[model samples]
Target chain A: MEHKAYLDMELLRFTTAGSVDDGKSTLIGRLLFDTKSIFEDQMEAVKRSSEKKGIQHIDLSLLTDGLKDEREQGITIDVAYRYFATPKRKFIIADTPGHVQYIRNMVTGASTANLALILVDARNGLTEQTYRHSYIASLLQIKHVIVCINKMDLVDYSEERFDDIVRDYKDFAAKLDIHDIRFIPISALHGDNVVHRSEKMEWYDGPTLIYLLETIHIASDENHIDCRFAVQTVIRPHSEDYHDFRGYAGRILGGIFRKGDEVMILPSGFTSTIKAIQTFDGELEEAFAPLSVTIELNDDIDISRGDMIVRVNNKPEVTQDVDIMVCWLNNNPMQLGHKYILRHTTREVRAMVKEIVYKIDINTMQRQEGEKQFAARDIGRIRLRTTAPVFTDPYRVNKHTGSLILIDEVTNETVAAGMIV
Target chain B: MSHYYLNHLKELEAESIYVIREVFAQFQNPAILFSGGKDSIVLTHLARKAFFPAKIPFPLVHIDTGHNFPETMEYRDWLVDALGAKLIVGSVQDSIDKGRVREETGLNASRNVLQTTTLLDTIEQYKLDCCMGGARRDEEKARAKERFFSHRDEFGQWDPKNQRPELWHLFNGRKNMGEHFRVFPISNWTEMDVWQYILHDNIPLPQLYFAHERDVIERNGTLLAVSEFLNMRGDEIVHNKTVRFRTCGDLPITGAIESTASTLEEIIFEVAASRQTERGNRADDKRSETAMEDRKKQGYF
Candidate 1:
């Protein structure tokens, strides 16, 4: 493809999770290297480090292990984002560790991803880490899941081993809420089925990892059935020309909005017609999900930040009581009846934990009931009652409108990530 | 034709504009950190678009190391005048004269590290609550983990391990008094994306970004431009070479690359075909593997 066409390509943000031995970093490095994303200086530095460490082959993992302690210990401690591009799409890989202790990091990385790349070793088949990562991805409502059966070279490129792993994964994934799951056999170490079609895997007639990433159907990942627009801020130019213009600026969360469409503002229950959808360039005739534009109403209604605009027929639930599956992020344990700040969409309100319903054991897929307190990296279902009404949808329907974060009042640190149930 | 969705560049621009506008609404005092580089220039352009018909509501802060390229200074002045925006200059030389920071000595000495003290001082002096930067995550390894709304403590130290979880378009810029946030509007953009956006928007940049003939000395495999800030070695010889800078920084630390791309199209093509990262020419990042991380923890933009 030409450079101009490449510039017009779409973007796909994905997250990769695997155990330390599953060659996750090697897979990412191979993708970058084969796609010509690895620059000459970076390659040279990796080579020098490999020589200094007395390694025979260049350690591709060093490219991703960026921190000093991580490089010294040869482990990725936190989430690291890597960017690369192909002629078809631009890719952002949120590399997260697969260890159980870093579940919060995994959740943090997977929260914004459209797809999840879960790596499973061919020799080991599926381990507890695989189940944990897959469960987390499902819980995060990642629409697409690509299971890369890696280290095929270690298994002598055997078709039976590959089939067994796929079968095992399918059996385990049946318990997951994920719908779209695809399997690709790859040997990240030997550059097989990563960027290029593998000649060794004759039995596997699937697309390469790069091909799948580039051509996946992601346009429909967003919810187009419900119309939701959360007002981020009111844009009053206060200038001579646009003095009376009160534009509600925000990104469309769901469905499509056009000029002259009748919309309703949430929490206030006021109805108005969209006079215009404006941008810096000009007025847009219509806008859809993920497009940040300003909407001017025909009537001068009471609208401000933290308000939501939606279709009258398809309005989200507005209530002070919210049931959510919360992922604790900070070291401070979440106490019942503890008041915290709840930031949902563009709205901020004080919320207190009314109850801790249960905590899920990600590895075993079992719920531990009657859990009183929650610590960092713990995932549990809880009931929260906010001081004001918050409009939200279930995470299964729309990831953008369904998620919120809990911040500590004193520290102002994001303590927990919640997915509305 | 009426399109329902935005292209990649348009989407990136829209996201950046949203973030910039959010900074205006969320923080009491915010400023754009302008270094006259392409990224900052693009950021300033986005800030203009974010509030059209109305002037940019904040000032442009430039931490001058007193070793900047002359073209950068000229461009910075022109941009501030064109936008009708306020300009705040933080000088490392002044910091040195005030005994707030000491200048480095020897051959590899640079004012790059001293700019941190000056920057923090400027923030404190101006009482700027949030400083918007043009730092892209794709620039360096340490930057790859940066949050869009990065929080700094009372002393302006960054705690990478304890960063808040940034989710979707909702950014938490809430912080205590004396603590500030370093918000990166273009955190998701890469080097190629920046150049592509510049070309797409017809954004004017400093002349140093394009190919030009300059007297440079090759040291440590990088071509360092000869200037007053650089101390020449006994054996090092200056030679006129056709080179262009991939990044703009202090005159001594920022290296130039051999290139013949004179136009934006040619520059974009060259960037696409180039084998080295954009920061490969930066001497500050080459000091150690974690140089950017360490400097960033100490409040380096």
Candidate 2:
């Protein structure tokens, strides 16, 4: 394929998680190398490191060991992002550690990903770690889940073994609320069906992993049916060239937007029409999901950075009682009934945990109903009441409008990540 | 096109612009670290788009090592004039003469490391709380783990393992009075993405980026330009070659690759086919496996 073709493809961000010895890093290394994403000097450095360790072939996983301790211990200590592009798509792979203690890293990486790649060893089928990773992926509302049953070579690429693992995963996944699930048997060490067709698995007749990542329909993933825009900054040139240029600049959270569309700002509830959508150039006729543009309103209604703009009739819920799926990010336990900063879209309000309904055990997919104290790496259904009403929607509808972060007042550390539900 | 969903470049651009604005709203005093390289150039361009009509609400800070390519300096002056923004240059020569830093002596001695002392001094001298850089994660493995809002200690050190938890689009820039943050707006961009955005925006770059003839010598398999600061060995011979710089830093250490890709279009094509990483020619990064990580830890931008 032509290299320019890769430039035109849409981008996708995804995360990978598995146990320590499940060959997660090896799978990523093989995908990058087989796709020609690894450069010559990088390969040479990896080769040198491998030779120093008395290895004959290149230890592919060593390529991503970026930190000093990670290289010394041959393990990933934190979330390391790796970028690669095929002819049909651009990808941002967040390689996260799978140890139980690093569960916060997994949540952080998977927060922005549209898909999650869960690696399960073929020999082990599904273990406790597998269930933990899968549950976390589902709880994050990742639309697509691609389960790669790796190390098939060690298991002799048996069809019966693959079928049994697939059955178990199906039974487990049915209990969750994941939208799309797929199973692929792959030997990440041998580079089978990653970027190319594998003749060893003659019984398999599915697209390669790269092919699925490229062709999977993601356009329908965004919530375009609802119109939402949060004003980030107000642009006023006050110069000779563009003396009257006033634009409300922010990222499009959802829905389709265009020039001459009627819009309204929240809190003030002032209504106006979009005159011209301006970028660095001049003006654009239309804009859509994830595009940041400076919008010109017909009326110069009072608007600031932390204001919301949406369709006048189709508006989000404006209340202080916000039900959320909260994921604790810090090592400290969440302080209940304590005021913390709640940041959503462009607005910031003071909020506190009103109630902790239940905590979900990631490994068992069971809810602990009686649990009141919440700790790090724990996900629970919580009720948050903010000081000021924030305009928001359910996370299932729009990720941008439905997501928020809780900031500790004293240390200024982000303590919890929540999805409005 | 039916409702043109943003391609990769647009999405990356949108996210960067969002981060830039967040820094502006969050920090009381912020400045962009402009090295006149492609990454910084792209960043400045994005900042312009981030706050259109309203001049960028911050200044452009350049930590000069007194060993820059003549073209980069000229480009920096022109951009400052064009953007109508303030340019704050932190000079290493002044730091050396004032005994704030000492100059290294040897065949391969460089002021690259000394620039950090001057940079941290400038950050404190001006009371700039936030220093937005153009560093990218795809450039090196150490950079791959950097946060969007990277906090530095009071003494200016990077603790990769103990960074603040950055999630969603929220950036926490709050710190102690003496402490500051090094915010990378282009943390997610790759080398290819920077070039493509430059081409798409028709942003002018330094002349050294295009094919030019220059006197250089092969040092450690890298074509280092012959300069007053660069000490030539007895066996090394200087020759003029048609070359272009993939990245520009101190002239003595920054190597140029032989190429015929003069225009932006041709350069993108050449980069696409090239097997070596863009940082391969940089002598600073080649010193050790942890060269960048170590320098970053010591507050090198």
Candidate 3:
């Protein structure tokens, strides 16, 4: 048996964005293939596809195209996820399309990503599509950004061209709300500076893309100050062996959970003590953020689905009226004063849009007021009135418990993504 | 004896539990699709942990093809009695007897494709709004792009390309009167993670997973167990070999592999070092390149 070493770290998700023919697929393909994370059958499928296309060479870009129609059209039209792992960390790649008309697809992909991989062609410099992708990535609160200057092979791997493009990108990215920005020169077609160092660029001095992905410090990405746990289901064996096990099953939204702690259940206002935390293997003394475990309480209360369990001292905002920034996702336009289903955490209630305060322009970042009508893929601010009081945190406070979705009652489709402001 | 963190495995389990709860909160009538396989068994156990002190909210629905292994039937019955949940069995034999479906007769005859007809009929009769499945994305190419709450049309058909956009933790489970959702809680788990979690969790499985002496014959580099449903060819010779199943299915199609691993720990180690996939031995999948995709399009869970 081989000895496996464990590296403790947090999880980081990122999405790749660019225009058509900007080599976004090739760049991602190089990262997965170079890491030796591509499965055998996946590789075989790519090989057979490339052969059918009669390219006479293995096209690495075929790896991310999961659908048959996408392969036949030679483009990525939807958001697909690809997973890989190194000895240091695990990676989840949100491979999104790079077309202008599919801006909604980019938003859906970058919604949960911690970083963004913005590809740039060295010869073409920066296009309007590049700016749009970067702008949306910034709007989604992605803190880390990597601007990969690709196609250095066509320019004879010139250092001057690489520096020229990096300067142009910096000037545009400075206007956005971006903090951490890095540049790397690479030829994704030739596999340079992606996983291995390229000798052609003698003046380039930096770690390869694979090295950065494996060594980037992302341990403190989660908010651990506030404690929140939404009750999913109440566990009860009701058998002879174990009868008095009243456990609250849910994922810890934030903070830490330890034995002998005081807790409160929402809507019911019942308090109890945390007796033990149990997994499948055994009981643990403590559990933390993002880990799901069954929590046994000292006292059994009237807690069910759509109820929240939190620390007594720390509580979320409980209100029926909320101001939210919503992005419309359906083709039909938004109808004012219309009621729909608003699902937050584990609770669902009927909600109506009271007023549309304003809509944000994606190109200029300006607010359009008094324009209440919104089409598909529209981002705007609105006030919502629900039937019942819901507990929620700000979007910045916690991503899991703060966000929600709006569904059309008639069409039964997810009409929008809403974030509590 | 020591401090350890199964980071990936724990994350997968947490994600699955979250999805299970989402189904319970969103849908009105829900049930689990249990086949007595490893994945379904793991799902049943997770449902048990999801609601402690209270019973599992939903029942277990099995679309039996009437060609299952004996061990699987015994395990399924025992689990149902222990959990005290209702078990609904939709038989392919019943469907065939009533002219709901026809049994194919040829060299490559199989009941795998016919299971879809029985499954859809069962869903329509029960009026189940959501059916939780144990399908994993890592097992097949068609399943790789599936969402947590997969939507089915009025005819119980799955459209692979035009799926609804699923983002963040918000799952949309709204549908019309006839449509339903097929939710997969463990869509992100792989074969290796499933094995490790089973070992760590101490989940009981069928005896066919372990090594035993069985009369089998070699066909297309795979060992097929000799049973009543399977007809032996002239050139094929039967012999006794120590074999175990990678995936549990019907008696005629699912093939077993030669192995010496008899314990859970040994099976985990053997799975970790193997290069071939776990579904490589499925004779049903070897029928055509798009066999699974076609079956899925016709509403096979």
Candidate 4:
């Protein structure tokens, strides 16, 4: 096996979801602390804050609950991003508050996560909040789910209790669309089965959480068969050195784009051959998903921002009507026939909510009919008719090309996050 | 074929460049907030690559506190001239002289907090709809929750709890008139990443970052560099110490640490092995537990 250097390691972004007291923050704090990501100054500050608040033990939650109101209320109000890395891979944790009311924040956090860490208390087993979060993980098309049975010390580190909770969770998660579900029994507070193996759980045999995170096969998570490049902007350097140079600059959403490959531009339907893939360092032979590069074409096609370049044979669905699953993010309820600015990929189009199919009861995973009003944190299926054609694919196929956001024209605030169906 | 992937530093640079380009395409008027710090210098370099062959589209806005090291001012001028980019200075000294803000009178007074007023004034005066900063999430706790495209209200106040949800590569910069967005192109880069990038790209930095012999005084465990703007206190004796600044700010409050690492490689190694964060030496952030959060709420860059 070829050894990978620390700098060349791939990055893995994951989301953690747990109830208010499920030790989610503690788990993250342990990961960061054990990995030496937390510095002495930050730890000292955390200690000082703990002392000032009259807390006995250092509140690890203080490390992530950064807002003043959150620190006062002792609850996470928004999505806080935390980064730590092992030698094997770089990790980014989207720590989302696990409350039924903060579903929008969870969705926002989980939208880009490759894995979802769902914490379950050994004493309490699986609760409605767990199911809701798991359903969200499934809805957002998160491929991997790790059911961490936390606080095993409270249950005396019994293997039988771990088995029971795993069984219960498995039965409930059978309804979810998630694959690659793994179970681990450990105590986040005591640092068991996290970065290091716990001697107490002798009967339990599995890789540690950090080990699993570092070794997960995420290279295939992206869709490499479909080539999608949404032009974000045009790089036109009319300088004397490189005058008349026009390059399309954007990040490759999926698949591989190589020089000399024939591609077609969307909406305009103009075809051209890729002349070169350029970067600041130099030109490349090919580029793949998630890489931001500039491409020069042989033909001077009248292409601009919001246009997509793809293979001629493979194409995304371009239509005016789009079916979507929306999670409302604003205080105002989503009204039918209300116009909004829909931002998909790099294109923006005016869209109207034509109909609300049904609202899903997140706790029970049942569709609730006769609900016309969609309030904040409401997840439902809706039909939208756009003023112009938007190129898209199914959310399950390509996350980058399938997702969008709705902006209220009056306030220009993003009101809803949508996944195309 | 061998599997190909970008190293961490290259990936961060690409992401930042992409963001800088997006700002150019999305906003009507955008400017780079250059602070003469390493992070801002890296941001300026990324902007240069983001629009290579063409001069940087946006002007560089410097919020001058008038208490900077001479080395920093000289480096800033040289960089702006070399890049051939427009420079706009927002002077805190001018603000104080015009009675726009009051200067601090205490022994430990700093123009750090006062820079916010000059920054807001400059933005309003220039009608800058978008201002790009070099803030990283790893620097402070409150910054961890900041979005790539941070929105500011008409009054330029940041509501940390009510930030817009940023997903994937989709960033929403649309806003009503009189409101602007503060875009951070390198929010994910860490101190190590910054040093590694500087080393890899051979990016030029101010001389203060490298270790050198300088007159300093120990106060509250922080080494205060001897400068004209820094007021000497009684019972404090000046001593020549080989030290280097972890961060650049107003010379009065910005602290330096004793280090022998002079070269970029040695600095990188030292930073990698250091126990405390880079911002630990900044006296401005030590004011309170939630000092950065409070400053961010009031539109402090």
- Model 3, B1-301: lDDT tens digits are 0122336667677788888978887788999999999999999988876664466788899989988889999999999999889999999999999999999886556788889999999999999999999998768756777888999999999997677777677788989899999999988777766776787778999999999899998888789888877767778899999999989887888889999889987887787566567887788887765667778888998
All models, RMSD in angstroms: 1.6, 1.5, 3.3, 1.8
lDDT of the candidates, in the order given: 0.90, 0.87, 0.81, 0.89
Worst 10 residues of 2 chain A by lDDT: A1-10
lDDT of 3 by residue, A96-215 (tens): 887766776787788778788888898999887788788877666677888888999998999999888988888888788778888999999888999889999979998788777776
Q: What ordering of candidates by lDDT runs from best to worst?
A: 1, 4, 2, 3
Leading candidate by lDDT: 1
| Model 1 TM-score, all chains together | 0.98
In the range B1-301, model 1's lDDT, one tens digit per residue, is 2245566787788789889978987899999999989989999998888776467888999999999899999999999999889999999999999999998999999999999999999999999999999999899988988988999999999988778888767789999999999999998899999999898878999999999999999999999999988998999999999999999998999999999999989998999988899999899999987899999999999
User: Model 4 has how many clashing residue pairs?
Assistant: 0
Task: Provide DockQ values for all models, in the order shown.
Answer: 0.63, 0.69, 0.39, 0.58
By DockQ, is 1 or 2 better? 2
- How many residue pairs collide in each prediction? 0, 0, 9, 0
- Across residues A1-421, which tens digit of lDDT does each residue of candidate 1 receive? 3678977888898998765588998999999999989999999999999899899999988888777777888888788889999888999899988888888789989998989999988988899989998998998999899999999999899999988998999999999999999999999988999999999989888899999999888878778778999887787878788879888888788989989999999888999999999877889888888887889999999898899999988999998999999999889999889999999988899999999999998779899998889998888899999999999999889887899999999989888999999
Which residue runs does candidate 3 get wrong by more than 4 Å? A1-12, A18-20, A236-246, A267-284, A295-302, B1-6, B53-55, B211-223, B231-233, B236-243, B258-266
> Which residue pairs in model 2 clash with each other?
none
Q: Which numbered prediction scores highest in DockQ against the true structure?
A: 2
Q: What fraction of the native alpha-carbon contacts across the interface, defined at 8 angstroms, is recovered by model 2?
A: 0.65
* DockQ of model 1 vs. true complex: 0.63
Taking all chains together, each candidate's TM-score versus the true structure is: 0.98, 0.98, 0.90, 0.98
lDDT of 4 by residue, B165-198 (tens): 8877788999989999999999988887788788
Poorest 10 consecutive residues by lDDT, candidate 4 chain B? B1-10
